[model samples]
Target: MKTLVMFGSKSDANIYEPLKSRLLNEGHEVDFRMISVHRSPELLERELAKVDAQVVIAGAGLAAHLPGVIAAKLLIPVIGIPCAAAVGGLDAYFAISQMPFGIPVLATAPDAYGSAVDLLSRWGRLDLQYTFDSFNIVMERHKRGLPHFQMLLTRAQAIVDRTKIEMKISDRPVENALNICLVDINEQDPEAPMPYGPAARGSDEIRIFVPALSEQAYREAYAGVAVIRRVATVPGGIWTGINNVGNAMLAALQLANAQGAHAAFLTNAKKGYIHA
Candidate 1:
């Protein structure tokens, strides 16, 4: 509920104002201050001890060590927002990002305030969260023939569409279009009857790349839906199948990024694909 935001210089106030306003709007206590690590180390330390907060976000430019220093002193989570003060902020970003073990600083670009907000929102689970396992679990759940898989597909479509528009992608489908492949459960297990048929359930709105064998059947089965006969394998087992999907999503995201598209790619695990 309480957040302590420290900016290294008064000149960086413009960068801090929006984040401060966002936290205030969310009805959280935001203590904003300008404390330089180099100029006023003692004052910064004294003020840090005085402040009581659930999370601390520090902004610094040019060899930014404020967030790392804050993390070194406090047990609470520290998020670093690298300012574009020197070398377009790359120097500051590396400063906080390359913290030694036992001291962890969450690094983000100065413009990515939303990333900080998201971290703060889920600050309580920061310590307990296993990021790799979390991603694997998402894939595992999808393999059980659950609805989350369909949800992920829908979210991926939205991301692709938004990115296309933002990047001025042509309406005509080209070789460069982000290809989204869907697993053919029936093909993988011919004996087992697929409840949703060729494609997964609730996947009516999005484009799905199907295996060559079941391409015609899926097209006939689901009218008005886009289905492609692309080279995609649907290996047996829940984990293997899910890994295939994750790989496909990652490929699509990479293509989108390569095309200079505006994509949030991994906004949330339950909602969209996480770029892990």
Candidate 2:
């Protein structure tokens, strides 16, 4: 598989270098470039217009719009890495993860080689089985704290009940199971050994983080789950407020099923709720 790796600034080399090297070592072609969306919008547009690659990986910090801009122009999947340049990288994380509807970018942690490789594996470029094998052992030893947010729990449960998908709320992940894990960032302790225990267990599981008001909590959780199978955020970001647990659950369900179902689900969900 051929990949085009782009970053906004040369300072982001530490984040994207390992990723590029790993891709090359795995016998995949990589085209690396430094193109800032804000500074060189015209050049970025021109380059993306004729770029020949199956996937595009773009990294940037502080208002990280490189990946979104690439995604807006390309038909291929764009994986975004939010470097920790400002505000513990939460600003870049939100900017990349919370992209508007229709332009989808797979936002990931600063060290996101595993997610990128996993995505390529899913696309038939590599035969790697799983990336979080070590995480499983750690997750098995530690116990997850009981959920603290009752209101969010009730909302998530209602979403699962309505969808008729079997919901299991546990600290550890089930091996080889096709499940969507709903994690409430607001209920986690920053000092906990493994705050993202459930999400670390397997590559088949999808994790949806419920919105939280604390910037510290968000930063810690995003760093904790460095290489989960997939990560998703609430639809409207902060505008959805802290009570968008239901939206997170819906996102989980949407990811759990076929991609074709997303449009229909969004249409229905937007009728009364989810302005985004």
Candidate 3:
């Protein structure tokens, strides 16, 4: 898996490099860059398109807005790591938390702790399910679910009609992920960035991070593993995902940003206080 690590200029390399090294050991290719959201807004904006990262962990100290603008692009997930040197991590937290709705980013503590591996592991699960779903459906019709399809599908159809929104149709991602016994079914996205709305069965992993969601809303959407599926685009949209478990943690950070959590809280670092 590939991850892009973006850090603020003011942040100490002592803290930043260690985090990058951790990801490297975990068998991931990380793009470590020292461009701050506040210092180099122009260059910062450009990298969003350039870096095709599965996950982005953006770190900063003091009043850092690096993760905010990056998440605003509404592309991949942006994780903010608040440095301890900045107001005990408060400055980083507030800056990230104040993001307008619909923008999602993730965060981690300055020391980052054991989160690097924890985050990427989730992405790996998504990739696993994606692979299985594709094979079960396309290769063998009966391989995905309980024996004999016609009767099972009919019953599933009835369930959808009774509750509204497709439930467990054979073609539905929900069924593929569920019947296939996927662990993190919700992590998958309904529609991948592709030519169509959803992809072929099990084309890619979908990681969803939804906050303040109703039971009904969550159930109907994310019913499949297709790379392209239209499941009602909510304001927060789906939190971007990676192909494995570790990156999922990265997605979690960005999703927290969407829910208005501060980036500082993500880290155990400190920030400076305002002066007269």
Error of 3 at 147 (Å): 45
Local accuracy of candidate 1 as per-residue lDDT tens digits, 1-276:
688999888778767888898888877789888899999999988998887776788888887889878877765557788787865665665576555433446556444565566444433222222211111112222343445445444544444454343222121222212223334334334444322222222221112222222324433533112111111121111111121343334323322232223224322321333332
Off by over 4 Å in 3: 128-276
lDDT (Cα, tens digit) per residue for candidate 2, span 1-276: 788989999888788888888788877799998998999999998898889786787889998989878866754557777788976676777677665544556666544555665545443421212222111111122223334345445555555554554555555555543222334442334333434432332254434343333334444545434312123332211111233455444433333333343445544553434432
For candidate 2, the TM-score is: 0.56
- Cα-based TM-score, every candidate: 0.47, 0.56, 0.48
What ordering of candidates by TM-score runs from best to worst? 2, 3, 1
**What's the C-alpha lDDT at position 96 in model 2?**
75
Cα RMSD to native, each candidate? 18.8, 8.4, 16.4
lDDT of each: 0.48, 0.54, 0.44
Q: For model 1, where is the 10-residue window of minimal lDDT? A: 231-240
TM-score of candidate 3 to 2 decimals: 0.48
